[model samples]
Target: MEKIVSFIANLINTQKQFIKDLKELKNHKDIMVKDDEKLIQQFIKKKAS
Candidate 1:
């Protein structure tokens, strides 16, 4: 029983860490998309002018 509990605790900890990493990755992706859009807009403005 004790070993089972320990295993479960470890699994929960790993899952929590995975979730945190996933959130960070999503945030990073959003920032990259926004940066890319800004760059494209600037390019278009330059071309128009």
Candidate 2:
């Protein structure tokens, strides 16, 4: 019984960490997308000029 409880606790902690990492990855992706958009716009403007 004790081992089962410990195993379950560890699983929960691992899941929480995974979720946190996923959120950070999502935020990073969003930032990258924004940066890419800015770069594209700058390139277009430069080309036009």
- Give the alpha carbon lDDT tens digit for every residue of 1-49 in model 2: 9999999999999889766654554465444544645655544454478
Writing each residue's lDDT as its tens digit, candidate 1 over 22-47 gives 45544654445446456555444544
Q: Tell me which residue pairs clash in candidate 2.
A: none
Please state the error at residue 49 of candidate 1 in Å.
Answer: 44
Model 2 spans > 4 angstroms off: 29-49
Worst 10 residues of 2 by lDDT: 25-34
Clash totals, every prediction: 0, 0
Q: How far is candidate 2 from the true structure (C-alpha RMSD, Å)?
A: 13.6
TM-score top scorer: 2
